[model samples]
Each structure stands twice: as structure tokens, then as C-alpha cells.
Target: MTIKKWFKSGSPWIWLNAGAIAISMIMVVGLLSLILVRGFSHFWPAPIVETTLTQPDGRQVQLLGELSRSQTLPAQVMREAGVDIPSDIDLVTRHLIKQGNRDVWGRDFVWYPETGMDEWRYPKEAMRLERREWGDFYGYPVRLKEEGRTVAEGEKLWPELQQRVDRANELFDEIRGIERGDIGAVNHRMERVRLEERRLDMDRRAGRIDRASMEEATVELEARRAELADEYAVLQQRLDQLYQDVRRDTLVGRVMDGREVEIPVGQIIRAVQPNDMSVVSKVGLYVAQFWDFLSGYPREANTEGGILPAIFGTVTMVFVMSIIVSPFGVLAAIYLREYARQGPLLRVIRISVYNLAGVPSIVFGVFGLGFFVYFVGGAVDQQFFPAALPSPTFGTPGLLWAALTLALLTLPVVIVATEEGLARIPSTIRHGSLALGATKAETLWKVVVPLATPAMMTGLILAIARAAGEVAPLMLVGVVKLAPTLPIDGHFPFIHLERKIMHLGFHIYDVGFQSPNVEAAQPLVYATAMTLVILIVMLNLTAISIRNRLREKYRSESD
Candidate 1:
């Protein structure tokens, strides 16, 4: 076709649209691939390299760690950074070595020019310890000691060390169970008793109860407190025993500098000789590490370990928000579409709803903080929990407040979707129902709503996708860097909506920006970002699946 004819026929625009879509799809896939490679590769066991680095001053130093990253730097840039780079060379190769004995060297990574590095070797006996604190340790195992006595050395030390490490981990689990389960329960009960006693005292002061009754209630609460204290004591005793057992064994490791350092068995999460591991062994270790990253609780300022709590909190908050927003949004849409008169006032209200959807999410967070927390929550605390005044149970940032705020923020989307769905139903159907002697309410309830279910789910899917990745609003409403306990637990009422929660979105922000160790935290940032994307996709897919099924069901019924 001629150019003018093509323009008039919109052929150019069609091609242009296709090109744009193709580019967008490519960009999305590329971004996801980058995240997957950078994030997932971190779990694989990389062989540790021993090298001698010659300094600009002609001093040689031993280096031991995994090769993290390599980059080409301009000679001028290297010179500007005070590194000795020859002017003859235009580009200098630099390597970022993850020399991960952070506790010994005070740094986890260091950049070295490739020119100064030589004598690279991989020692089979080289060890890497993933620890509970101070990051990873790179060294060679010298001996295994039990309670300061040498139990094994030389070739036999490796097997003995592995066995004792396993035993230490088992004891660690026992200690954690005692502390978080039995002891936690006792502490919770004791706090309840204390609150009850305070309530009784307040009632007495207000003359709401007789003095004798108040005294009896106080005595009973005190007895309950004493019983809980005894229970805690027993649990504490068991935890102490576990701690001793876990710490009884130690590994003497010789670091790159040839200094022997003793590490407690309890502090080591995993021990591996990467150089000696076969491909199969490395793959197995990768799977275990990846699983732990998904299921373990984060430690070390959220720079290490798994994000199970964040995952649970994100899903729980989204689930709760969906439940709260659905009925309210659907009902509002029904009223506006089926009941409200089409006039200037209705048009204005509709315009306002659309505007609300465009409002900044941070504004909604402020509103939630003021109206929901300070006003509603404060009132609840006053009326229902008068004795807990200063503490302000509900009058604080918590899981319920965050969910409610998100529900409010996404309500307009749901309303718009549902209204559009309702409008799509032919007017003839309503007239037919009316002619059949069905009331307006019956026709709307039985016929209109069922057919519109899919659209409602579409809105829910959008809401979940947006809310799951939202960080700013959640930060002000409820999300915390580290929540000591989950909102849901084996406590009275089961789900404590008043508790603060960890969210994957917030965790990403914290780890990426707020971490003290920038280089070490970089990979974790990508991993967490990837995790958030995956979570949002999963939630959206679930909603999409439900919507499709509902649409199919209604279509079949109509046929």
C-alpha cells in the first residue's frame, strides 16, 4: 500500500502497536530473567579460591573466599580510586572477592585488581561455615573439641565435626521450641493475668465492685501469675540445658592469615568444603539453601536467612483485605448501578469515587492512622479495655489497620469493576424477570449478582496485585522490620489483628536500603524483590483462575 493509503487505513498504527507490545513483553521477560539469575544463583555452593594478592607497596597477602563479581574498570577511574593502574592499559579488570570471615576481618567482601592477584588455588580441605551471626567464615578445620577437650584431629576431625554439628543443630531446635512455644505461652498468660489484676483494681476504685470481690479477684490473678511463672521457670531450665549441649562442641579453624579461631557449634548453621563437593552434592546443597531461604526466619538485620514470616504476613493481610473490601464494594456498586437515580448528584458521586481511586496511597495511610487507629481504635481501647489505657492495644499500627486501610484504598477499583459488570447485563433480562412476577430485589440477587461474580473477582485480582506490593501505606499502618511473633498463633481468639506484622514488600525495602552491609545485602535484595514478584503473580493467578471458572459456570447456566 502507498504511505498515505497505509496511514488512512491505520496499518502503520497496527504495526506500531504490535512492535510496542513486543518490546514491552521482551522487557518484562528480561527483567524477570535478571532477577532469577542474580537471586537464585546465590544459594549454589561456589568453590573457595586461595590466592596471594600483591599490594602496590610490594607486600603479599593471602586471600581466601568465593569469587563474587568481575567488572572492567577504566584505568583513569582505578587511578582516581587510589589504585595503582598502568596508564598503558585503557581498561583494568577488577574482581569482587567475598572474603567472608566478617568476624575476623570486619569485612565480608573486598575489590582487588586482577593484575595484583596470583597463585590462585582451590584447596579441598578449605571450609566455609554459614553462621548464625557475623556472616560466613572461610577457613580450614584443624580440630574438633568437646567442652575444651580435643575429641578428634587431622583426617578424623571432619567426620566428627559433622556429627557434632548435627547434634548441635538438633539441640538448637529444642531450645527454640521451648523458648517460643512453652515459655511464650506462659509469658502470654502472665501478661493476661496482670491485665486482669489491673482491671480489677480499676473497678474497685470506680466502686463498680465490692472491695472483698476485688481482693478475691486480685488474689486469684496473683495465683495464676505464680503458676505461669513456675511454668516459665521449668521451660527456662530446659532451654538452659539445651544451650549448654549445643555449645559443648566447637570447631578450631585456621583462617587465611593462619590464625586459629574457635567457633561454637551452636552458632554454625551449615559447614561445607565446596572444593571437595561433587556436582550432585553442590546441587543438593543448593536445594536445601533455597528451601531454607523460603521457609526460615530472617536474622542479621534481615540480610540473611528465609522470609517465611514476611510471606505469611503478606498473604494474611491480602486475604483479610480481600474479605473486607469485597462485600462493601459489591454492595456499593449494586446501589449505584441499580438503585441510584441517573442525575447530576449521582454523576458527581461517581466522579468523586473515581477521584478517590486516584488519590495518593500515602494519604490513605495518613487517613487510616488518624481515623481508624487514633479515632476508632482509641475508642475501642477506652470502652472495651479501659485498664490497658496507656498501652493502647488497638490504638496502634497493626495487622487489622493495615488490611482495613488497603481495603479502603482499593475499594474504588472493585466498585468500578462491579458496576461495569452490572451494566453489561441486558436491560431485557431485568424486564423479563419483572414480567415473571419477580421482585426487583429477587431479580438483582438471583440473576444479576451471579453473572457479575467474575467481574468482582477481576477487581479483587487487581486489588491484590496492587496491595501485595504496596510498602508505603503498610509501613505507616502496620508493617515492621521484624515482628517478634506472627499475628496468628495458638492463642485466645487465634488471630491477633492488633499485632504488628512483617511484609515482604517492607522487608525488601529494609534489606535493600537500611542494611549495614551493602555488598552482602545486594543479592538478598534481588532475591527478595523476585520473591515479592512471584507472590503477587501467584495471588493474581489464583484470582484469575476463580474468575474464569465463575464466568464459565454462569455461561453454561445461561445456555
Candidate 2:
């Protein structure tokens, strides 16, 4: 039991390993707990407090906001910082009030000492408005207005406002569908027509165009343009109608400053009086907010709303990358482990692949940009899409280039994993298959590959886990702060690999570090981080499940 004796007996090593594992588990649990508490709680309806903030000059200022956070600091530190600390206690309590009427208060959050606040109470009538801009508005509903005229007043206005919001949301959805879908498709088609015309013009300039053929093409192009113009005019008229409907309703609410402001109903995302809300209502609101976070597109420079695009982009890129990396990785591993003559050259190649795994991912991004985009993509554009020249379709940083770069970045891990898996298979199996008149290629493809699927999947899982969380490489390759259009749409060649994409990893970095509204973006950062973790876990779990299923099937066959 002596320390040296225990160490000699390997008990010390066992204890050390246990301690390391315990510490790691604790760290992980703690991190997850912090994220969950901070992230999930953000959706809960917090009561709005109507209070009088007693200023040092003996003047009371009316304030309305949600009580967000509280902290206790040493009184000595408070006093040193020139805060009016009470003499009775060694600690001074302060609370961060989310005074969210940013336009009125000129600030989203404010801190007040306990002693500096008087008659603060959670009022049932106090409202919190989630606006499209200027952040949240803290006020009381004075009335509801439609087209500058009073529609509903007092308590009756609440139900009326809700109805209008529903109507506005529906109209908004319609407008969005028209703008992003129909109009977008029209724009794409129009662009194609323009490109076609350009191509025709180039041919004419080269004296390759027949006069009759050119005239026919011009007529066709003009006819298409006229049709598109008519369609656009009709769409514009419908959009105007929708806009009028969406903008007609307004809420006349009295802010904390006693100023009655008219907030356009179209600008409001949600309005809720949290203090008046029942438990059931609160739960409903919470679910609604959470769902919005999950499904909604981001706004306000990605500080507000959901991250659907980022999620979609991340998953799609990873999926595409997996498809690309799997075969190449497996083939390379096969060549090295099964077929390649082992010598100095083979050893050098193996070492190179391993070293490539250690290369910084951003380097791969640069390589992708230079090689895949500028060189190969430029060649593609020149050879195939010459009309779209200078506009740079595949020649630009895009989803395909990003996926390919990530595939290259993660290929080594896959190769190493596959090699290990291939090496583990008994040579007798291969020999037996060959002995039974099975060709080497057939045995390798059917028997060897099947058994090694789980290992391949494991490598894929690793690759995906790394690729999904990567932001640096993506920034250079394809990721943007916000991508207005998704890579996938109803356009020709349905999956637009040339489109730039939003990625959760990049979104987190942008909101957390690059955002101007740091305080407001903090919660979003935590929530996004938590979401990214969940997404990665889900993807890994899916791959792991497939791997497990394959392993089980093969194991049973072997038995």
C-alpha cells in the first residue's frame, strides 16, 4: 500500500487514469450544464418590472424592463468604484435590468443598485414587444391603431393586436414566398437569358453566328424578357398589396417615459405581457420561442431569430464532403494496406498522409481557393460556362469548393482509420476467397469492404465531427455572415454548389466575437454554441448507429 509499491504494482497508474477521466467528465458535465441553463432559459417569459429608479439628485425616473441578472459584490469594491453603498452590509447587491426599449432608453440593459431602486414591482399590464429592429420594446398597450385610426382601446386591444399580428405574419410569409421563390426563380431565368444573349453576341462578334439564326435567337430572347417583365409587374402589384396589409396595423403603446409611440405591427415579432401570462401560456410562449430559434432565419446581423440556413449549410456541406472523402480515403487506404509494395517509397507516402492530417485546415482552404476555384473552376467556367465569365460561378468560393477542401482536410484521418481496419482483417479470409476462385478485386470489394464498413464509418464520424465544427477554413472557402439564398433551391442543377453558405460555426464566431451588440449577442452565442454541439452529436450518433449495425451484422456472419 506504500506509494512506491502501489506505483510499482500499477495501482498508481490506474488511479491516475481514473482521476483524469473523472476530471474530464466533470468538466464536460459542467460545460453542458452552463450552456443548457444559459441557452434554454433565454426563451422563458420573464416578468416585466415597472419601477422608479431614484437618482442621486433626489429625482425618481420611471423605468420598465425585465429583471435579467443579479449579483452581489463586496461593498468595499463598490465604494472604491464610487457606488453609493449602504453602510450596514459588507456586500452590495446589484441587478441588471433589460430596459429593452432601446430607441427610447438608448440602451438595452442597465444596472441599478438595490438601494438606488424604489417601488419596483412586476406589473401584469406591462408589455414586452419583440420588434424587428431597435430590439425589444418595454411598454403598456394604450390602444391599437389601423392606418392611423383607432381600432381598439384598453384591454380589448390585446386580442385585436394578436389577431392583427397573426394576419401580418401570414401576409409576411406570402410576401417572402413570392420574393424568395417565384421572383428568385424569375431572376435566375432572366440571368440565364442574359447570359445566353451574351453568348450569342460573342458568337456574332467571332463571325460564327448565322444572321438568320441570330435574329431568331434575339426574337426568342426579347419574347422571354417581355414575359418576365409582365410576370414581374404582376408580382410587384401583389407585393404592394401585401405590404399595405402588413403595414396598416400599429400598436399605440405608452413607453416608460410616458411617450406614446406607434409601433408598426409589421415590425413586431411578438408581444407578450409575461406577468399576466398563466403557466400554460408561458409554456406555450417558451415552446414558440424555442421553435422559432430552431426554424427561423436570422435577422439583425444574425443577432436575432433562428439559424436554419447555417444548420442546413453545415449538414449539406458535411454530407457532400462525406460522399467525396469516403471513396477516395478508402481507395487510398486499400492501395497502401492491401496492394502497395511496402518500402521506403510507401513509407514516405504513409508518413506524408499522416503529416497532411496535422496541416492547418486554413492552409487547405487556401489551396482549395487557389487550385479548385481559381484554376479548375476557372477552367470549367471558361470551357463550359464562358458566357458567365468574370461573374465567376464555380470560380468563386462556394459550397463545392468548401466541401472538397474539407474532404481533403479530413482525408488523412479516414485513410489511417481504413488502413487500421484493413490491417486487422485476417489474411486467411482473403486467401480463402481467392482459393474459392473468387477474383482479388471481387473479394476485396464484396467481403473485405463490407467488414471494414464500420471502420470507414468511424473515420467518417471523426471527419464529420471535425468538419462540422470548423469555421476558419470555411470562412476562406464558402461561409459568410449571412447567405440570403440557400445552396439548394428549385433552380436548374437543383443543388447550387457554387452558392456561398451560412455555417453555424461561423455564425457563432460572428455573433460572439464580431458583433457590435456584444451584450445582446452573448446569449445567442451560447445558444448557438449549444446547438452546434447538439448537431455534431446527432450527426456522429447517426454515423455511429450505422457503423454499429454493420458491425453487428458482420460479427454475426463471422460467428
Candidate 3:
């Protein structure tokens, strides 16, 4: 076709649209690929290098670390930063090394100029200890001590140290179980008893109960307190024993500075001699570390450890939001589409709902904080949990408030989708149902709503995708840096809606912006961002699957 004829037929526009879509898809794929590469590689056991770094004063110092990153910068920038870069060089490449004995060096990473580093070595006996606190330790194993006595040294120490580390880990797990599981339960029960006693006192002062009944309730509460105390005592004894066992062995290691430091066995989460590891061993360790990252809790101001809590909180809050929003959103859509009169009033309401979708998310967060938390939650605390007054149960940022806030924020999306779905239903179907002796409500409820279910699910999918990645709204409503306990636990009201939760979106923000060690937390930021993307995709896929099934079922029925 001629150029003018092609333009008239809109052929160029078609090709242009296809090109734009292709470009968009490429960009998305590229972004995800970058996140996956940078995030997933963080778990790999990179070889630790022992090298000599020449300081600007011509003094050579031993350095031990894994290579973190490298960047090329202008020589002038280096000079401005007080680095002794040569004027002859226009550009200087600097390397960031993760010298992870943070407690010893007071820094987890250091930047060194490429020209100043030399004598690189990878020793098989060099050790990397992933600790429970103060970050990783890079050193050479010198000896193993039992209590205060030296039990193994030289070649005998490695195997003995491994065995002791395993034992210590086991004891640590047992101790954690006692502290968080058994002892936690006792503590919860004790708190409940205290609250009950307070409630009883309030009732007595209010004349809601007579003296005889008050005495009986007080006696029962006292008995419950005594039982919980006994349970706590036993758990405490077991916890003490486990702590002693875990602390019984120590590993003596020589750091890069050539100073011998003693690390208690309990403090070491994992010990690896990366240079000595075979390819198979390295791969195995990589998988294990990634799994731990997925299942463990954050440590070191959220720079180290796994983000299981954040994952759990994100999924749980989304689930709760779906529960809260689905029914209300569907009802509102139904009323607007099927019941409400079609007039200027309805048009204005529809316009308002559509406008709400464009409102800033942080605005919704502020509204939720004021209206939902301060007003509604404060009222709930006063009415339902007066015994815990001043302590504020629901009157704080928590899972329920976060879910409610998100549900409200995404309500417009759900209502619009559902209304569109309802509009698509053939009016003939409604007329036929009515002709078959069905009332208007019955025709709408059984037939129209069922056909619109798939669209409702579409709205839910959109809502979840948006809510899962929202950090600002969550921060104001519920999310915290670290929750000592998960919202869902073995405690009473197994789902603790009032407790604050950790979220993947908030985690990325905190690690990326709020962390004390920016270099150490950089990889974690990518990892957490990747996790949030995956979580949103997963939630959307699940909702999409349901919508597809519903569509298929309805199509078959119509056929």
C-alpha cells in the first residue's frame, strides 16, 4: 500500500502500538533480570582473599575480605575524597571489599584503590564465620577450647570445632524454643491473668459484682498466676541449661590484624572455609543460604539473616485485606450497578469512586491513621479492652489497621471492576430470569452476581498487586522494622491482628535507606525488592487462576 493509503488504514498506528508493547515487555524483563541476578547472587559463597593493602603513607597492611563491588571514578573525585590517586591517571578503579569483622574493625566494608592492593592469596585454612551478631568474621582457626581449657589445637581443632558448632546450634535451637515457645506461652497467660484481675477490680468499683463474687474471681486469678509462674520457672531452668551448653565451647581465631580473638560457639551461625570447598560443596552451601534467607529472621539492624517475618506479614496482611475488601467492594458495586437509580446522583458517586483511585496512597495512610486507628481503634480499646487502658491494644499501628487501610485504599479499584463486570452481563439474562418467576433481587443475586464473579476476582487481583507493594501506607498503618513475635503465633487469638508486622516492601525501604551500613545492606535491598515483586506476582497469579476458572465454568454453563 502507498504511504498515504497506509496512514488512512491506520496500519502505522498498529505497528507502532505493537512496537511500544514489545519495548515495554523488554524493559520489564530487563528490570526483573537485573533484580534476579543481583539479588540471588548475594547468597553465593564468594572466595575470601587475603591480601596486602598499601596505605598512602607507604605502610602495607594485611587485608582479609570477599570482594564486594568495583567502580570507576574520576581521579579528581578520588583526590577530593582524600585518596592518594596519581594526577597522571584520569580515571581510577576502586574496589569495595567486605572485610566483615565489623565488631573488630568497626566497619563491615572498606574501599581500596586497585593500584594499592597486592599479594592476593586464598588460604584453605582461612575461615568465614557467619555469626548471630556483629556480622561475619574472617579469620584463620588457631585452636578450640572447652570451657576454660584447650581441648584441640593445630590439625585436630577443625573437626572438633565443627562438631562443637553443630552441638551449639542444636542447643541454641532448644534454648530459643524454650524462650519463645514455652516461656512465651506462660508470659502470655500471666498477662491475661493480670488483665482479668484489673477487669475484676474495675467491675467491683463500678458495683457490677458483689464482694463475694469479687473474692471468688480474685482467688481464681491468683491460682492461675501461680500455675503460670510454676511453668515459667521450669522453662527458665531448661533455658539456662541450654545456654550453658551452647556457651561451653569456643573457637579461637586469628584475624587479619593478627590478633587472636575468642568467639563463643553459640555466636557462630555457620563456619565455612570457602577456598577449600569443592564446586559441589559451594553449590550446596548456596542453596542452604538462600533457603535460610527465605526462612530466617532479620538480624544486624536488618542487614543480615533471612526475612521470613516480612514475607509472612505481607502475605497475611494481603489475605486479611482480601477478606475485608471482597464482600464490601462487591456489595457496593452491586448496589451501584443493579439497585441504585440511574441518575445524576449515581453519576456523581461513580465519578467520586473513580477519582479516589487517583488519590495519593500516602493520603490514604494519613486518613487511616486518623480515622481508623486513633478514632475507631481508640473507641474499641475503651469499650472492649478497658483493662488494658493506656497500654493500647487495637489503638496502635497493627496488622488489622494495615489491612483495613489497604482495603480502603484499593476499594475503588474493586468497585469499578465489579461494576464493569456487572454491566457486561446481557440484560436479556436478567429479563429471562424475571420472566421465569424470579423476583428482581433473586434474578440479580443468583444469576447476575454469579456471572460477574470473574470480574470481581479481577478487581481482587489488581487490589492485591497494588497492596502487596505499598510501603508508605503500610508504614503508617502497621509495618515495623522488626516484630519480636509474628502476628500469627501459638498465643491466644492465634491471629494477633493487633500486633505490628514486618512487610517486604518496608524491609526494602529500611535496608536501602535506613540501614547503618549502606554497603552491607545494598545487596539485601535488591534481594528484598526481588522478593516483593515475586510475592505480588504470586498473589496476582492465584487470583488470576480463580478468575479463569470462574470464567470457564460460566462459559460452560452458558454453552
lDDT of 1 by residue, 1-559 (tens): 5878979999889999999999999999999999988888889899999999888788988999999999998889999999987668889889899998888999999998987788789999999999999999999999888899999999999888888888888888888788888888888888888788888878788889998888788788878888888888888888888887887888899999899999998899899999999999999999999999999999898989999999999999999999999999999999999999999999999999999999999999999999989999999999998888799999999999999999999999999999999999988888988999999999999998999999999989989998998989998889999999988889989999999999999998899899999988899989888888988999999999999999999999987
Per-prediction TM-score, please?
A: 0.98, 0.96, 0.97
Which regions in candidate 3 have their CA more than 4 angstroms from the true location? 1-3
Ranking by lDDT: 3, 1, 2
lDDT of 2 by residue, 1-559 (tens): 6877877999878989999999999999999999888988888888888878786668787878888789998989878888766678697788888988777778798878777778778888889888888999988899998888998997699999988888888898999999999899889889989999999999999999999999999999999999998999999999999998899998988988799988999988898999999999999999999999989999877888899999999999999999999999999999998789989999999999999999998899889989998999999999988898888888889999999999999999999999999878888989999999999999999889888888999899999999999988888888899999989887678999999999999999999999877878999988998899999999999999999999999989977
Off by over 4 Å in 2: 1-3, 74-91
Which parts of model 1 are misplaced by more than 4 Å?
Answer: 86-88
lDDT of model 1, residue 514: 94
Error of 3 at 303 (Å): 0.7
Which residue pairs clash in candidate 2? none
- Lowest lDDT block of 10, candidate 1: 84-93
Number of the candidate with higher lDDT, 2 or 3:
3
Q: List per-prediction Cα lDDT, in the order shown.
A: 0.91, 0.90, 0.92
lDDT of 3 by residue, 388-484 (tens): 9999999999999999999999999999999999999999998999999999999988899999999999999999999998989888989999999
